[model samples]
Target: MVREFKLPDVGEGLTEAEIVSWLVEPGDTVAEDQPVAEVETDKAVVEVPAPVNGTVKEILAEEGEMVPVGTVIITFDVEGEVPEPEAEAEPEAEPAEPDGKEAADGEPAEPKDVEATSGRVFAAPSARRLARELGVSIEAVDGSGPGGRVTEADVREAAETSAGEEATEEAAADADSGLKSATRKVTDDADEDEPSTDTDGAEAAGAASETVESADRERTLAAPSTRKLAEEKGVDLDAVPTEQTQDGEPFVTDDQVREYAEAQQQAQAADAEAVSGGAEAPAGGPDIEAGGEDERIPYRGIRKTIGKQMERSKYTAPHVTHHDDVDVTRLVETRGRLKEKAEARDTKLTYMPFVVKAIVAALKEYPVLNSQLDEDNEEIVLKGEYNIGVATATDAGLMVPVIKGADRKGMLDIADEMRDLIEKARDRSIAREEMQGGTFSITNFGAIGGEYATPIINYPETAILGLGAIKDRPRVVEREAQGASDGANGEAVSKEVVPRKVMTLSLSIDHRVIDGAEAAQFVNTVKEYLENPELLLLE
Candidate 1:
């Protein structure tokens, strides 16, 4: 009999999954529990196994197509019984409206034909689900079910039996567990006073307890951002105490977490030092050197996105970058005053807010810079509103969190949102949604000391601006003395480039979405604002 294998509920309330690939095809003989396909849900890639030992009759879903839970994915002919056509034919339907009565009331519908009995023993819904995972035919096992019913144990035993058959004499002969196999025997010596309900309850508790204990060794609990932070801080997963308890409450404070992380780094360094001293080497073993191999990890996350984007922009957008040094001596001094004024208002003023203001002003003059090429539709998408993406580097990878409706927000709001987004990115709290839908991107690599770099364009967006470190350098300046010929101020000052502060800017753009002329003009516009400083606050 050919049995239809509908997609089972793979827990986690998964609603749908995308078929990643198929391992078995029609006419291929597969054992019960052999993987037939891989499906990718939002969480992970899960293997879907055959439920019956049979030849695959058909595949119902194609690769990469999303299928809902309970959707049939494959069919198999386990026993090779072809029912007579008459037996398989659908029963005659009642007249429309079923003689004027709505369907599914007191009149019971005909039972759907069952190609295979659920071969499970001692079944709770969860146990039945687990049995399906173990690939054991519920029918083949002894039922310890409520009334001679099979349970998870029967399913597991069946799996182990099959697995044992594949091993060599030694390993198989020595009682062993097979691929999540375990045995549970329900004893008849139960206390007579124990309630009937308690019997099933005890079995479930045992199963759950075993599962939790085993999973503890393999998995650790923490928020995604917390994990990222731990990695960046070099905190070993095993050594870090769980901040959360079984009741799912956090007990550790952020300060305590940070301190613990720092301690771990110190301990690791001490261990390395001790090893180098030959104190920790195996007795009489050759001394192994510590830590010298260099590795080039491919830029991932935000960095990777930045790279692809810039490459596309440079090659496709016809990029022409115009460079001109700006004289921001007076602008720098003005910024100091603004900072003091902002401090009085309990708002911190950073150079970025000024740059953002400038960019906004320029966008009004040149909207073409904020457009994307819809190559498939052969059209350009000129965004009417601005949602800027700010490139942030976290320990795990780079992230570009967007500031939606950026053009509509005031400088203070923009600054606050930018601060919040970057912090979240660094902490790994930013979601995938927060990382997309930007008409433009700005990467401030200057904080890390680079003067200027040709930043890659953030795809879908025409360009990305890379800001470099601001440093001080000497320049010709007029020094005033009694209105006579004066020498330039040779000392360091905020406004004057007196060997104290200089900044660099790099802009990567998609050549296809933007022209070289347009890119240059945009950069020039930004430079003008940075140079003048005063223009950043136009009332």
Candidate 2:
């Protein structure tokens, strides 16, 4: 039976999705839970898995095409009929036809057949280029690679053996002339202690030796460029062995030839330097065009979803922003001291966990900032549970994954969850629900070297907090000291400016549900927790 697979909603309120690519084709076998297609939803890119193990029958959705949810995207054929088994049994009943012995050339001598290696052969792109340069037909080479794919070694072997056969025939046709020309040289090298062996035996031995050398020379396979390089460097291609081989013949590639040439140059340069008492000149870089101009990128996939989300957020929310600076000297000290302890518990303690905890606590103090506006009902709905969304910057765009029950988790647990969620978001594997149920959000532009940004509110959420880069700056503090009054009233007080760690904070809120006063108070609460990290322990 054939079953159709539909595209399901992978994200919250997702109506349609774009098919990024199809990984399976008709006649390809697939397993249950194996990914058959990659689809981009409104929030993230996700893989659609196969529901049953079967052969892919058809693909209905083309790559980059947007289709609505619940539409059939692919079809499969499960547990095909018994006709294949019957055919196999028929071949076994007729056992007299042995393919191996049917032809004297080891394989079927006939060219065209059902199982002929003449149509096409799978090969890497680089392998195909080498075969073309060597004038070898890749389709006719016997592939030893997995699934009968023709590799570069296969092509090189075909070229070498073909060249060898031609050389052997030429030597055979000119045997008499070659023997006469080498007569004097053979006599000079004959063993005098062996009584100057018979001229007939010497001629036969010499001919046999020449044939053997020619056959041995034919066993080495190399591409045309590599052959030329070996010749220019005065290196014998057959002397340089390679791990990659086809039919037990050593195949040389471009890299192997270059490596041999480089070694030779280095040795020669060293010898020259020793003799002349000076070093060789270094190589120069190539002269290429400066810029990568004329490049255009298609705006689709995750970028498309991010653009839509940004537009919706900007148009839907009337935003108000507030900025302030905080002294995080104490927070830095606390983290430095407790870092080893946090590592002992098998977790990394970062500023984000502290920020998340502070935001959750501030939401408790100012519940209005954490509430959502129900425009259809004309009511403000305050959520009791804290699911804080942490905005992370990724290669694609921004992603806000929520921390479920953030108010109930401790700093270490929150840090672990935030780390995992941030990684998943960057890798585009986070589940759709993980980005939902947020009452508030936070963006740390500080991590990317920004002092502050007017972060747009994550739609439906009332507020978002932006963190700036922390740096050392001068700060004024008040202290009481005896007889330290400034030349005025008799109040003994001292004020001095000293260097301290400082950070900038920005808060953007939905003006409909939150007022400027409420946003300020919420930020003040967060400042209190950050400046005095001890307050978090009490909470």
**Tens digits of per-residue lDDT for model 2, 276-323:** 333223448465688843433445556877787778888998889999
Q: Give me the overall lDDT of model 1.
A: 0.59
- Candidate 2 residue pairs in clash (backbone atoms < 3 Å): none
lDDT of candidates 1 onward, in order: 0.59, 0.73
The TM-score values for the models, in the order shown, are 0.47, 0.58
Clashes of each: 33, 0
Against the hidden true structure, what lDDT does model 2 obtain?
0.73
Clashes of 2: 0
| lDDT, candidate 1, 1-539, per-residue tens | 76889888663566656677899876689998899998754323467888988887657655644556776767777756663332344332322232455335332232222122432223333344545565444444565434564444344445545654444344333322211111122333646564442223333333333321111232343332344455566554444544343223332222333445544433344344433432233558887789964443423333554556557656666554434455555657777877877777766778887777777777777787787889889988888878888877766555678889866787777777888878877765555577777888888887887775767666767777888777676775544335443245544333333453456677766666667778778878887888887776671
Instruction: Please state every model's RMSD to the true fold in angstroms.
Output: 20.5, 18.0
